[model samples]
Target chain A: MKKIIYLDNAATTEIHPDVLNEMLPFFKKMYGNPSSIYSLAKSSKRGINLARERVAKALNASTKEIYFTSGGTESDNWAIKGIAFANEKKGKHIITSCIEHHAVLHTCEYLTKYGFEITYLPVSEKGIIDVKELERAIRKDTTLVSIMFANNEIGTIQPIKEIGEIAKKNNIYFHTDAVQAIGNVSIDVEKLNIDLLSLSAHKINGPKGIGALYIREGVNISSMIHGGMQEFGRRAGTENVAGIIGLGKAIELSTNDITRKTGYLKELRDYTIDEIVKRIPDTIVNGDRVKRLANNINICFKYIEGESILLMLDHEGICASSGSACTSGSLEPSHVLLAIGLPHEIAHGSLRLTLSKNNSKEEIDYVIERLTAIVKNLRELSPLNK
Target chain B: MEEYSKEVIEHFLNPRNVGEIKDADGVGEVGNPVCGDIMRMYIKVKKDIITDVKFLTFGCGAAVATSSMVTEMIKGKSLEKAEEITNINVAEALGGLPPIKMHCSNLAQQCVKAAILDYRKKHEK
Candidate 1:
């Protein structure tokens, strides 16, 4: 039997015990449709409303501002397309960064097909987009500016507050996809002046298939899903009662533990970075060192392919993700790595190791011990070993 | 969880003929850095026969497996016989590869042909 040490927390997280415990009754004894016309439905509706209030409280927003959706992807799609279509008469221009999740990028691209103009803001070598460059890119016809609060691949934390201030000065709506940053960092929607925000439960040790989109009060945005009057007719679907309960519990727990967990993760991340760079030669760490997420450690090894390293890591029962396209079905290097000025070959050698509160120093040491040997073995068999 | 075939994992665990032949008669290197698969093949030819072959590959399990299998398939065979090996043949020889990983076998096959071409160019007297 292999001792599994999972580190791909950015992709998804193991559900917390408290979250699972909260959701079981909804799946078994308390099974009732939130939209039903019976007293049995009271608990279901109460559960969803509690989840919404919890999500809203996490972002310092009003309860009415939080609307539950399927997940981050759906929220992102709705925010971009909903705002673009709703404000088409005002302007058809949108703004985003080059390192957004595909939910945002693809939605922007989808709108471009329908005659919507978008300007993708470029980033620095450390993966931080320039505020002045953003201000310059904004035109009178720009309707919205959507930027990620923290990047998923490189883990760069953009200046969302400053970007929001710029948008407010121009009276453009500001939306941020904070899926990766929600539990790992502190966020105050009121302080940041964020108009719209997207978050997923699974990223914070909650159940999957449930998320929330925070819309500021009185924002006249159009709806994307239009079947039932669920989600206040914004997104059309019967509410996921079990998943919502899980999310609320998960959010409550993670918010309380954020300070201690993030502090520990940052220490571990920095230690890992220091050790890898010191022990391994020709390594480049991606993302801004100070402004990056506490749990993300993205590094590139020269002359070694990431898929080979990942395969070898799997043999050692270590789970991580690679930016290389060979393992994934994509045919190009990670766009985030490339956007940060990495050469194509260097980008192919990148690895992302995201952590969680469950991780320990012993696990980190075990990874370091195995990774050193694995990199040596792969580099020996690599064609780039010149 | 286990996306790789048993044969692919076996070959990757213990790759054969992995090294560069210093002062080799012919060498071929091919890869697209964007896709992160690279192959370097070295061959020793005599009397139009491939007396020895070696491959160094930087890629996934499929790439390492295909390289090992391709080298084992072509050693001591005539250059003409070795040139007939294709990506499909290498994949079939190792049970099979996922559709996305077919390019790994393609890299092996292309490297063999490329090494032969390099051998022919140098000997065109």
Candidate 2:
């Protein structure tokens, strides 16, 4: 088998060895239910509590405020729909950005059909939502304001602190789908004035199928999923013991090594972007260069389809993704790219190469070399190319 | 990643005949802006036989590969026979496309038929 270099970290990450190690015992010897009262259950409860503490500490929140769920999508649904239904009496108005993940966007769309008015805040050409526009869009009955901490497609980091401040001033519950931002950047719920925060374990190298939502103390949220008395009855399902342990361990590792990793990834990401622009003419980077994720590089090759570039890159043993993996099978441009004012042709040409800690400078260089060759070849066949 | 069949990967990695022929005898473009994929096909037809065929696509790997394969499959065939190309045939030619990518091949076949109609329209005049 040929050696493949994986660079689509924004979509997901390889689980850290430390996290896997932490989760091992729970799968076998410590497989007791945390809800049970026996000695075996006591150890399971202890593990759950410790993991909760680590996760809460990472976000600067109380452990009691964190409710574990399936993953980002579930957490997002719980935060958006839960709040929408719970606070329907207050005001049926909700405001979210146009570039939110499908989880948030679709949830908001669902709410719209249920008599909940929704205003999609537009982002600037840089992909950051206009704060003043958000302020103006707030209504007396605005029950919730949900936006992503960072965009999954373009990697643009929004001004969550500012948005949170506005939501607080208006007495609206502020929620952010922080799936892409949790480990890549510092997130303090109190500092950012975040009311409800959604996180996914997989994005931070924990496990798949496990995530958590940080609900500020005193926030009103109805249960989206109901079953047995698990997660303090906030979410009702038997706890995923191993996944929670892995998530806790992963969060701990991410928070501890974030500074060093951020620096390294930023250096590597910027280097790759710079080389791509210099080596390939008419290439443009999507999203704000400075405020974007440290490891995400989205570029448009002016006259070529991103899928073609990805295919060539795959043949060369490089793994990455287009702007929207869900829409990759279709020929339409990415909604995020189109929202940012890219022409349809250029938008179709978008390619995203998101990195991980495991990716080295040598790997980055190899990708750059392969990508340059691929772009040049694709452009050679492009009718729009001069 | 699912192990893409050797033929599919070959078409995807090195798509054949992927450029537009300037001043071609017929040209056809299809796809809506909402669908996110668009294909423009060009053909040089002589006495109802396609002497050369090429395409320009703005879409994913499946779309590009499908268009490339379409051009290759129809280049030496008569216009009437080229119209027989179907989405399934294009997909099967590449071993098999993911179910979701089937539309890409559909778009390619549509482009071929539309281009043939364009050729017929020109010749009848």
lDDT for B23 (candidate 1)? 72
Candidate 1 ranges with C-alpha deviation above 4 Å: none
For DockQ, the strongest prediction is: 1
What residue pairs are clashing in model 1?
A: none
Per-residue lDDT of A166-190 in model 2, one digit per residue for the tens? 9888899999999999888999999
Evaluating just chain A, the predictions reach TM-scores of 0.99, 0.98
Strongest candidate by lDDT: 1
> Which residue pairs collide, candidate 2?
A331-B36, A331-B37, A332-B36, A332-B37
Report the CAPRI category for model 1.
medium
lDDT at A319, model 1? 95
What is candidate 2's TM-score against the reference? Answer: 0.93
What is the DockQ of the complex in model 1? 0.70
C-alpha TM-scores of all predictions: 0.98, 0.93
Q: Which interface RMSD values do the candidates have, in the order shown?
A: 1.8, 3.7
Question: lDDT per residue, candidate 1, A163-257, as tens digits?
Answer: 98999899999999999999888899989999999999999999999888999998879998889988877778888899988888888888877
